[model samples]
Target: MKNTPSTQGRAYSRRDFLKLSGLTALSIGGMTVLTACGPSTETKDSGATDAKSDTASSFGEGGKLRVGMEVAYPPYNWQTSEATDDTIPVEGLDGAYADGIDIFVAKKVAAAFGLEAVAVKLAWSGLIEALNAGQIDCIIAGMTPTDERKQSIDFSDPYFIGHYGLLVKKDSPYASATSFADFAGASVLGQKDTLLDTVIDEIDGVNHMTPVDSVPAQLSHVNQGACDAITYNVENRGGLLAANPDLVAIQFDGSYQLFPDEVSCNVGLKKGQDDVLKKVNDAIAAMGADDSTWETIIARQPA
Candidate 1:
């Protein structure tokens, strides 16, 4: 139930997800300028199991815990120029900052470990690699703990649980869809390299469009009629609706669950960091079972 910094407006563009090959140092006072990966559909093998470093009770150098996330995603994480007491400055981004539920939890974990919390913006695909390569200490980017990913890295317990829903233009014929079967031939879209895109195949006979690179791109495709619909997390319903009034959510009946419950959300980390993983899990558990705090953060996300 705490307020954090947020975007001033909801207008979005493709530039929001920038891909750069420049190096981003995780060590404090080490990086003068930083560049990060952009969104892509490809899912590269994490190979995290083979990327172990010396085991230490603490993480990062210079008393800093570098946390990685896709700052462009709201509710989970987003970039903003406004700095409040609750916001963490995005490393290497002069005036910009990061704020959301992910950041909230990141700060909590950093505090528990006695380190300065720093937000490192990264591409969706880069999060796992960054953690393994030591470019980041942890990933607090609303990542799910899939068996495939677990093979490469470790994960904290679930933080925010949300249902999967589709977003369609408010006036579209498919706006009234009440079940997955209602959109047999519909052209559905999803963010590249995400569970959202993976679930689109469940709709029988549906035309699954090539996944876009980012959520902003997904919103653009649905808003501009480039696609009939896009998959999204239901927890972001309020913010998404407020930002794009022309869109409507199709919450299908209980015939099938579009998203699996076990993979709701978690903090991802590198393999062999058993101590770090335990500390991260402990930090998450300390946040408790009440969803109210997490929901409030979601509700207050930038529209």
Candidate 2:
């Protein structure tokens, strides 16, 4: 694991999911800043036929690194209507582009593999299936690789290390909370199929509501008083607060306990693809070696 550049917000890690799962080309001289659809849940088919049909000799034009993401996770990844010096036009989707830390990371991996980077928009629940079916090459969306996820697909070295936190209305009673226990008996929102959903159980008496698809939806629930708070990556706290100033991010300190495997995010790859894995890991290691570069990329995002 590498040390992630610190932002104005506190970063905490999400506990491991036993599962796995951005962009832009704002040039920092040699880099570009840039920027999913899918089922609501993982299906058994995994589109294996599609993966077989799309097999290529190696990772750009011959076989661009088809990366899948939800494009709804801001600060990590998000969709934009226009392509700019800071965004990449999504493949197979018109009038849409992407930007954020994930995009920067994807481009680095693609460049390392000597391939082109193509953004594939897939539903968060469907990302794994897309990868298994070959709808995309890999998943770089702030996904944490756990033992369970490793059984289905391989994960490269972690590119981003983060922790989970909650987003609540600034004026809400929970705003000054110092621990998950503070939200006890309170309604909480999280994305479907994500570790955040399961982590809510740690809140003791929390009212874990049904999960939703996007951050916007989760935040909406919080804003509307449908829920008192929502779980998210601590790295995204700054972004969340920036996007919704009315909301405050609560990250626990000594009062919170995170297991060892809980909070690291890594690159996800198809099973038995060590060749591609090495390339991505190498890229990640190289990127980690230069903290300034990572900080520059992080600074580019609004959050």
What is the C-alpha local distance difference test score of each model? 0.66, 0.63
lDDT of candidate 1 over 1-303, digit per residue (tens): 111112222111112111000011111111100112222212233432234555232466878888888777766787767787667878767777787878888888898888878887777877887777777888888776666677888876665554466889989989888877789889999887777787787678889999987877888888899999998866565566666779877754532224433235677887887888778767776765344455455545553
The best candidate by TM-score is 1
Winner by lDDT: 1
Clashing pairs in 1: 19-38
TM-score of structure candidate 2: 0.75
